[model samples]
Target: MKRLIRRMTHLRHSDDQISARVRAVLVESLYASPRSLIIGALTSSAIAAVVAAASGDEWLIGCAVLIGLVGAVRIVDALRMRGSATVRQQERGYRIGALTYAGLLGVFGLLTLTRTDSGVLDLLSVTTAIGYAAGIAGRNAGRPLIALSQLCFASLPLVFGLLLPLDPLKALLAAVILLFVLAMSDITQQTYAVILRATTASEEMAALAEHHAGMARRDDLTGMANRTAFREHFEERLRNLTASGEHLALLWLDLDRFKEVNDFFGHLAGNALLVAVARRLEQVLGDRGIVARLGGDEFAILCGVADARAAGCIGSAMLEAVRQPVGFNGHDLRTTASIGIAIAPDNGRDADTLLKNADLALYRAKEKGRGRFFFYEPLMDEKIERRRQIALAMDGALERNEFELVYQPIFDLAKGRITSCETLLRWNSPQFGSISPAEFIPIAEDNTLIVMIGDWVLRQACRTAAHWPADVTIAVNLSPVQLRAPDLTHAVLAALSASGLPPERLTLEVTESVLLDDVDRSLAALSALNRIHVCTTLDDFGTGYSSLSYLTQFPFQTLKIDRSFVIDLEHNPASVAIVQTIVDLAAKLGMRTVAEGVETPAQLDQLRRTRCDAVQGFLLARPMSAPEVIGLFAEQAAFRSNPGQPALPGAD
Candidate 1:
């Protein structure tokens, strides 16, 4: 008896385990079979309806099956068009489903009224209507429309049955109940659809915002962060590095002679060169640090390095990267960059200070002759401060008319008389005394103050020369920066018109370096000046490349021999040969030659023998104020009037 009992207990346990496994399999199948939902609902409802009709006593079963069939069809249609429904179509579907549900509930209520007692039908109708009302309220995720729809649907069934009972109140109540059920089902589906649409819109908006932000930070030309973004990122990194005891280096790079390229070629070619330069920089430094376009041929890099040497290596790499030729607009162009390196904790702790220090270092590198890098030093900061003070003082000096011009006489060798005077700029700063032209000219050129200063010199020279004999011409040196100004031609015309000096009496001396900078533009400017009949002289000839070529290409009236050759002519045979060759070449070109810095009589004699057209030095007369020059000439004229004069020894 005990064994039989134990066997029965084991069988029972086995049965329970099998039942649990079957239920798990059924649940998994149902979830995975999405199409089976509509299929199963329709099939079940059809089978139930057919069975009820054949039995003839199951009207309630038929009605329930019909309701299930209609619900299944609507859900399946919604699923079928889920990926293809237009917004308007989707809204229309919601309305159709709502009205269908209402019709179905009304039909079910009518069936109940025909079979059950009046009281029973009324109660069933009210209960079904309440369920429909709740479903509508829950639809649209608790939107006010859902609650209003529910309230209207719920009240309709009771009110219709009470007011308009043509045959029986129960029948009307049943119809109203059926309508309420369908409305609730429609509300539920519409609410789910609305939630999905809203979610999609939010996600799309977020993505668009992210895209715009990315564009805002990036430079369009180089695809690198722009100056504004660079500053923000640089500051953040600096703060982090400061806390971590790490060092950072900032390199400010400026392309040497980039403007020459732009002037020679068109701006399109210039833009192409810039793009190619950006690519080279990216290839060289992108892996190690951050690079940014600080605008107009200037690029900045932020590097994390252990020491200054490593930072230097990176800078050297960058220089080499840009040295390669970039082909643009059918021309192979070459360029080089001057870099300034400023180390954190050594140069400064913040972005502005570091950037300023790097820029100063860059200036030093350029002054040392480009294609090199310099680390910021204490002395550099001192020089920068001094320049700033000088620039400020220069600004005030212009307003106070502290700048003055001194005339150095250019004597005609054949006539042995002063034929013209070259105007030399002199700055007597109240704060710092005498500032060298070599020092201040470059500063002025860079800051664009040269334009103002150049204009002042032109007006002053013309005004002062007007006081001298009309036969004596006045020569003014023009800085290359001033020549390249867009309004340069206009400015010259205005100065001539205002000063009342004949263009024929004015001589403009330009360096060969200016021609090399932009041969075409320089020629154009020279041609314009020549059209006005101004004498154009090639200043400091033989010192720059392509001098002889420039002499033939442009319409120059004179060649001023550089003082270097003149100073060593007495000592160096080669120097004398070079001077003689230049003089001969000038004669061949039909341009007069002037020898500057003639000190001794022997030097003057040698220059005369070379057949140089003119000479200027302390040996003849030093640079003097306008009045001093007029006084010297007056004294010489008086000496000539006295007989014996020896004819003033060739002073005609």
Candidate 2:
């Protein structure tokens, strides 16, 4: 757990240095105290000018005039610094002005002592007068170095001038001025520390705020900007386009088979694939535009383009980049992306419209065929709206009992009798009547409705098939979604117990590819089912990831030859060879084989010749209603038969 937290921390932005940022803020704010500094300087110059005139010393009057000149120059520089934007330039100007102010204070202290008849009275007065200007430096304590420097330079000169005179009062006044300078120096340092600490705290807060804002804008899983950031950034890009009317394209991409990845692999594996895809997008596009993960498996890109053809070229490149294979858990997994492009001004003038059009184009690309790209068209929105409505309606279809199960019988070709029946799901919606399983099934799987629907089908099939002959086994397909369910074994057992059916007469068929999702978990679930004597088979056998390894690792009872191979039996020798190979493999492994989509007696004869154990297709029987299932069995007196055993009376 600590390691996972550590990895997550590594992905976040590194924190900024509070002290350095605080320093920059202070330097930029060098003009913060100019008004007070000017007021103190003007007041000091006036008082020193009065003393200079009373003493009748020309040098004292000259010192006050010089101080006034320096004060005026510093105030001017401070104003210029306030107008400047650069921190470094502002800081340089502030330091020069402060030094000049310090120099003027030093000159005033020296001028008071430069008199020839400077007695104990004059010296004591000079020390007391220098103390007033020293207070001005204390007022500028936020600039500690300048404040402390001015105090020390101004007070030390007058104190030393007093020390030169051998008088108790002069020495006492000199010590008092020295004490004043020391106190002011401490106050300046302490005041600066308080200001600096405050600045540090403010900068820390700013940094923390920025970090949180960045987190909100970025996807945690993929390290790409999320939808909010994408919208904001794309709008900014639109605003920045030059008057030459440069074309910009917004490409929306969605992984074609991302759901299959999550189903076949686990979510962790799916997350890893998304991260890899994010990197690939970064590498392919590189600074040409912005690539962001809008949400799960969907991404959006904004890039500069000259025309529609340029956008198409970039979209094609993105498609190929996503098409590359990813390796996870010792398997090379392949996926493709369907991309949609929306050009600025051509598709839509602004961000929201362009994004909607891009998304529409993406759905059209997926609808046409996966692993392709499409440009936005106005009509695509209408088609996608219809699909969106269907998907929404499916959410309540099962609850409303719009779904039903039909059983297609599997016949023993050699013995000429029904061995088992495979359950097929069908949905008849009031809004869209008789939606094909191919259409609605994927939609359900994509939206996670399949798991509930699959569970319902399992229970229904078991309950309906319980009254069938004891020798007959009923097969129902298991979706990968159900296989991932934690309560799958319990659900199956409950269904069997409720239906009063023996586990021996119940079969759960899974696709070979779906079994790859957390293989241990699937195996453990299947193993638990096996303990109750339920039969397991790998259905649509040769269609995906056909590995002999799974056949051995899993206790699959049958390998159903896919319809594709069966249909090509008379025309394609390779299909025939493949079927023969699977049949021979199944036999040697102590498993049965069932050929699917057998529509002709010739195909059945060919399957029988190949020694395939059973056949299922329209030729034997179409999927029938539950009552029709009973009627056919009663009319035909269908009995389970084993080819290896001697044929009993009325077996065919």
Candidate 3:
């Protein structure tokens, strides 16, 4: 019994709390309009006046005066509540006035119905009281307590007065009045529930709309602002800075070798790393700036800075923050970022130009090598224009016959003969005159023109080599972009078939970069070439990570040591050792080794001591035209027949 009492008490308290919430929602409706309040006041005044005049009773006259006062007060309260700001205080006042007025009406009804026997007075008293009770259902329905209170206060006394008569007709009228009050109670409750539901649903819809808007501006993975939000924020900052005469900095950042992480590890790990990096950046910036994840492996920051130097300080801090290794899945995942900064009114005032300039600076930073920052400069625009010009010229250069190939002979150190000639492309544009391959080749690759240009080089080299001795093979360099082409093997076969050059007489060289990304695809392409009996060399060996793994991964016929090591072979004992080690490694693997950029006799002597299979540089011969190569071939043939002449000297 005690537990049941305790539970009932708890339930009653819970119900009280719910009733309080419902009352709060509906309370304003009680004061929504003054028409009902005004009507109640006038009706009370008229009834009191009529009852007092008809009966001429002193006590009833006093009651009439009280009714006038209460009616006037309630009317004034309702009128004053029109534009009131304090809802709680005003609602309390309204409730007090309402109950007071209703109670006075009930007192007057009982006085007129009991003391006065005049038929007209009794009829007016009963009708006025019942009419006021019925009006409470509509007027005070928002607060069911007030509605029900008004119903009882205004009509219960009249019911009592009617029952006091002890007549069947009067008893029936009293019971009908009681039934009317009960019906009004039901109507008031139903109305309150409908209003509450409508208000709650409206509030819920508004909240849902706000949440969706927030999601649209945020990145789903990192919870950082997305590109759309970033641009909007950037424009807002720009506008504010324009007014305040302050400088705003926009920094663009890109993760270096991020794709490798996705390739080596899985994308889930990559996403986690990105999230970790974002948290670090936010912590480093604190409230000093806004960092947004623009897109995959890219982010943008907006901050107020004094100048380029200040921006550089922030960029340095970001670099240090990002350099810290992120721990993921029990391993330390390390990465670095390159930053590009563009300051407002200094780089550009508009958002588009500033963002573009910042991205351009980012490209420059990555180009100079990652893990650094670059400020936007006007010169970058000129360089971009130059690239655009080259891209345009390259589109028609092949058709204009502006491109040609030159062959550089690879001298066999032991055989004392030219074993192979590597094909190099040259472009003498009518517009720009003799652009170096280093400058234009990358631009060509960026624009995807390298594939077309590479195909032409392959065919031309094969045709040129078909005229040379069968022992003299033709070598052509393949860019990573060209290797990624879907029909690379077909292009190679077409070149060989069209030129009538044997597949064994052709060698395709690729750098370790090709094997770095998408290694499976790269290996497949090289394997296809290998299957056709065309030779493949891992060019610029020892310059990339896991060089030995690549050697084991593919059957490369030759390994060309990067010029970086061979260039120092004359004086650096380390370089000699490295070259000797590579030669020994290649010999054990049954692959020939070629040393590039061998210029001096000392370098040559060191390589010879190292037993390098082949050497190609200015020490033996520079690259020459096809005619010069044919002439050199004739001279070599004559020397072979003579058998007593020294080998050809190095060319300038």
Candidate 4:
């Protein structure tokens, strides 16, 4: 039984198992073809040599030559099978080889059936048929169709010859031969079933394995490689870099303000956006690098170039590609990415280290500002760890009420009194002594805690200011995250109602950066606020990309000149000219202008002469506690209403 199984089976299989034909060729190359060729060549050549010695028959000699030619062809086909022949070539070779064997066996059988008359010839023909049957049963069972072909062509004519003699003994012999042919045919049919079953099983197993492999390596949503694939590929590239003495750059990119897309448009749109982004990365990077999705809104690239400048150029190109508008269901959605890069051997020698360093650089790019790229530096890791610690501390700071707002008065220059106080959020955690807004706010934004914190800030600021004099308004800066919230207008209205602050007494300040993404949504949100008489101010004027355009689109009652322009106001003509131009523009547009960060007397004098509507800085009044602001207002209420007291020098 074991011997039969051994003869029936082929090679188990190789790892690259693709199709059944490939498996058959591999098996025949290793087993069936060579064995059958050896037996057939020895039997035919020896019979031809013997017949030539006994009768010197030219016909038999010619048949011998034909057999030799067939043998040679089979050998060539076998060689092709063993080598690098393509699947099509291998299948074609197998078919031709099988046909050649069938034709040669048919010719030998015909010689016995029609032209042969000698006793030795009769014996030779019978012996050849019997041997052929035995050989095919053993050697060709694995490929049953070819085995049956050879069996029929070799045995059927011998049976025909025996029956034509018209004798009872010969008739009986023919009956026996026919029975043998029936038995061999049955074996071939059964063998075909077994071979087909085995091949189909193998194909099914291979398909299942391939499906699992795809699942493990590919992201189901984006169809790009997943984290496991990224790590393996990145590490392999590192090894190649070591051997080739070349450099590889690893880029970690994150979509800027991507959550807002999900928040506003729903997860389906966000998912479609991710798929589009993956395709865009493939289109932009092409063969220059490998792109993989690290996880939501984050992707990593492995580029062959080690040079920072070349990588930077590639990064810039990718940025340009992503910045194009993606049209979805007639809505044009735009997005940008922040990229961080780390070079191989310079950043790290392994995948984990390289990914880590690249992530560190990514945050730096975000910190400097989003929609840019930064290279990895040692100091970045320290900053990253610091941010991580701050993020950990901020988890419950709101519930604990560790957050407070300090009011910095915005002075009314023409009125000679304080008009509004800008509410600035402050966090003095028990774990970390007073964390800077610059540091903790970004952490909150990254962790998706900004909206909750912003809502809390708005409610608290309004509640605190509602107790102040009705004329003193409260101004609050809204995060882009908060602006993207669907219920932002409702949140503002709820805050005012909860605080009993009049709608007109609350102002919301926003940057042009907030409006850059989903302009329609931001515009709608600003309009909603304005409809309720909530004043809108464009904060950090001249600092964002499109100031003039923003002023035209949004109903901004006030424009605050950025601190950058104010710092060098007296010393730099460019600064003075910018402030003058902004003031002039604001006046013509009927909007108030506030110059922030005023420190020296000359800066204040220049701002007032330029007809700036208001000023807010340390020179006038520092950010103070609510109680301190209440006391200052109480002390100034009588003096302000008197209308006879001169304003403090720069406070105006």
Candidate 5:
């Protein structure tokens, strides 16, 4: 009998285990369906009502009410959930879900207090179970699986109640199954929400990283590759070309006199000019090359060309690109560029070496007169090395005071007397010996040493003029580079003040080329000097595009005829006629004219006949030391005293 009891106990334990497993599966399946949850609740309530009505118990009515209320609350929740899902805004959906869940739970709690008959309560319980099962199943399967599961579960209690005696065990078992199903549903929902959040966070992180990397690679101002990215890309291309036996070229481009643009028009206009230049380069190069701004007025291009000729073609295209004028700040601004090209495998195999060679070529291109390009060559490299040595030696030369000034007399045609002396620059390099102005002036201009050289010239000229007669003016040729320096006007004003010389006694000679580069700025500088009573002269006139329009546009106190015309005065009638016309024009404009390079008496005679206001040439005196000039004046005084009068011809 004991052995039989043990077997029976073991069988009952196995059945309990199987029932728990079935409950778990049902809970999980129903949790995934929305409609199943509402159906399960309704079935549970109906079963509770039927049980309460058949039993005819007063306490059973309370259970009936509780079951009905749970069903009604879940039904309302399912409807609200559907409504929330239809909303477009995510926040609004979440807010409605939270409010609906809370309200449903409150209604379920309130319904637990009312009483009803046992049969009715039992029917209500069945209805509630069905509604809950249907809601959950619909939510999981997107169908009505919950209603089927609840109907199946509701029949368990009804079948047990009708087949056996009434017991608390059946009621306890029903409550336990309901709680188990609810727990399973909550777990499924929480797990799905976690997965969704993880996916969203990952996508957001990827987008943010991509955005930052893009920003890092692009130039902030010009929207091109920045220097760092350019370097990397250049290196990669170099490697590819080396492997493929293909050739590439690097071009270094620099805008001539860009600083003057910044100084005159402000940074806003300067930025506009840079952006305009970038667009032009892109349009010109197209797919032939990649262009990058190497910071402030300097740009570079990398071209994948097969030969030097192809590279030359690219350079020519770039040159033509910048030839068009750019309008900025309501003014048409004209700019020119000097380009230098270095071929890979010919110039250098590496980035640094290639860039260095390209820069050397750029120096040569600028020296050859800007708005042109030069290819890298062995001879060009040699010349660059020589200049580098000279530049190094110049620093020491300045310290040792190797620089000297020479004065050339400016003779008045009307008075026939020396009225002014123009200061000429002379550099004596101890290592190189007497470097010519034509050679080193350009080097200075390129390296920006002209600012320092110009300052020295201005100070020396002012000091010399202060010692001379107050009426005699001193003319100093201001280089285009020096004029573009940020503090140029201030430097001139300070030099005049420091030397105790009057502004009226100082004459600044500017070339036609200076005026063409940023005419607005050039005019502004000239106007400022004029306001200070400084005499402004257009030097080297009739040489470059003699636009008389500039005369009306710019204020000038004097016009110096270039030496080219003066040198041909005796041979070329056209030269004579041109000089005559210039003098006539000056007279009409009420401007003074100076004839330069008057080496012969014939040229001087011609200039005098033309009513030239001044003449500066070897005929009067070569540029000499200040003391030598004073000595010459004394010699001339002595010669005048002895003149049995083979006297110098007075203004004819």
Candidate 6:
């Protein structure tokens, strides 16, 4: 009994799961339209008229009247269904009414069969009953149960009445009618299955389309609105705010030093950190605004505010939220964000304009020092336009011969002669003459123009130094962008092979920033250079964190103390101690040291006492053109030959 109850419950649950629309459609198929009902009623009246006229049977006439009444009632019910709450509500009533109509037709047919002896009456009544039963299958197949019930109600009585004659022909006819009823039941079941399958597949397709649309608007990793969706929302909000004259703030957020995290940890850890940060931003903003991940480590926020002060407060909260360290893979990944706020109406109201200005402000924040926010100002646009013009001019600056290399000699403090010259890039554009390296080199790096420019510098420096005295090596600065290039090692080899300069005569100078990005890759590149007998010098030594760790990681031939330490060596005891300590450490590590920016004789003398290997500064020589460098080498050779005169003009 329990098993039976469970099976019945399961069936009921399955039935209840069908959508309401499908159920209504099935019920609607059971009730004919008003026109169809009226036509069916008139047909019944006609059949009754024919039978009663032929047989002169008053009982047949009465049965026909009853059938007509039921038909009229069914027609009235069908008409009412047009404005009904739902077709499903009238399902049971319609089924009963249909069965009644079928039973009355069966009664009329039976009375005709009993009262008439003519073969015509018998044939007409029997044919009408079977025809009505067959017609029910086509009209009511959406509801198989009701269809089958009507079929049996109309046909079974005639089958029983025909069997009462006890004749073989009549029994065969009855058997044929029973067979017709069974075939109709199967037809109804098949038709119902087809309708149900079609309806269900359509519903599933609609739901799947809606799901895909939602996915298109969402970020895959962070599950926030993507760039495209954010833009649309931004435009829509702007439109809504236009008439109200209220201000909306668009905050452009960028994670600072995120690329370093990706380089140190793997990309998976970076992605996990991004997801955590997105959650924090969402939680911090809550219902006050909408946050979107606008690709990479950048995000955007939209909120209504009265002015820049309110926007600044929101930006402050966002910065604090992002400052929280996220734990991943047993390490606390700490990051900070820079925010740029552009207010609507005051900042030109359109999405593209506001976003561009906000991005400009964000760049300014990072430029000044990150972990802060800035509002868009009109002056920023002019500065950005200037930067854009500079970038555009740089695209073909090398091909136009606008770049030149100058050499600054590094003198041996004890030997009192130049040992190496660091090549410095200079841009003398005809459009904007004498652009500083500090301003333009960063612009080049930002646009990836540094890679091509750095390569040229390497080859040119090698070629220039090939003609110099063999004892004097050449140094070329490598940017962090160049180190990440896959062809860095190849570029170095090609430069050496083309210039006919020995690998030992070339020294590649790298700042500590290089090691901070992808330590393994940087070490591999440096190791490849070392294998080829090329020297690597760690420039700006004391400015970076983990300076000692970097020295142990790679085989650097020299450490150049930063100019900040060398400039104050005479007056500041701490600077003197730093220089001495670096000199001692470099000597112990078997690496040479050079003091940069040594101007005063006192600073140079102090460096000499500390046993610094070399010094490069304006005191000895400024960066000079290639021709001047060649002349200086010639002067040194002249001094070597005489053995009496000074090797340099200002030598001690």
Please give the CA lDDT of all the candidate structures: 0.73, 0.78, 0.84, 0.79, 0.71, 0.84
User: What would the per-residue lDDT of candidate 1 be over residues 539-617, giving only the tens digit for each residue?
Assistant: 9998999887897799999999999999998888998999999999888878999999988877887887899999999
lDDT of 4 by residue, 177-196 (tens): 77786677667657655765
Selected candidate, larger TM-score, 1 vs 5: 1
Pairwise TM-score winner, candidates 2 and 4 = 4
Question: RMSDs, each prediction?
Answer: 15.0, 9.6, 7.9, 7.1, 15.5, 7.9
TM-score of 1: 0.65
lDDT of 4: 0.79
Query: After superposing candidate 2, which stretches have Cα over 4 Å from the reference?
Result: 1-18, 28-30, 44-65, 82-89, 112-132, 135-137, 160-171, 241-243, 259-268, 327-334, 407-422, 430-434, 469-624, 632-652
Model 3 clashing residue pairs (backbone): none
Worst 10 residues of 2 by lDDT: 7-16
Best by TM-score: 4
lDDT of 6 by residue, 1-652 (tens): 2433353355346557888767776676655456766777778767877887778788987887788788888888887774555565588788878899988878777777667788888887778777777877778777666677788788888887788879899899889888887777767667767877886787678768888988888999999999988988999998888656568999999998676577667799899999999999899888877899999999999988877888898999989999998999898888899998899989977999999999889877877767899999999988776777788889999999999999999988767788999999999988888899988898887667898999999999999999988899999999987876767888999999999999999999999977875687789889988999999999999898889999899889999999999889878999999999999999999999988897877888888899999999988889999899989888777877887886554556
Error of 2 at 644 (Å): 33
User: What is the Cα-based lDDT of residue 541 in candidate 5?
Assistant: 88
Count of residue pairs whose backbone atoms collide, per candidate? 8, 0, 0, 0, 106, 0
What does the lDDT come to for candidate 5? 0.71
lDDT of 1: 0.73
Q: Give the TM-score of candidate 5.
A: 0.63
In candidate 1, which residue ranges exceed 4 Å CA deviation?
1-215, 220-223, 240-247, 256-276, 304-336, 345-349, 392-402, 484-494, 546-554, 569-578, 600-611, 643-652
**1 versus 4: better TM-score goes to:** 4
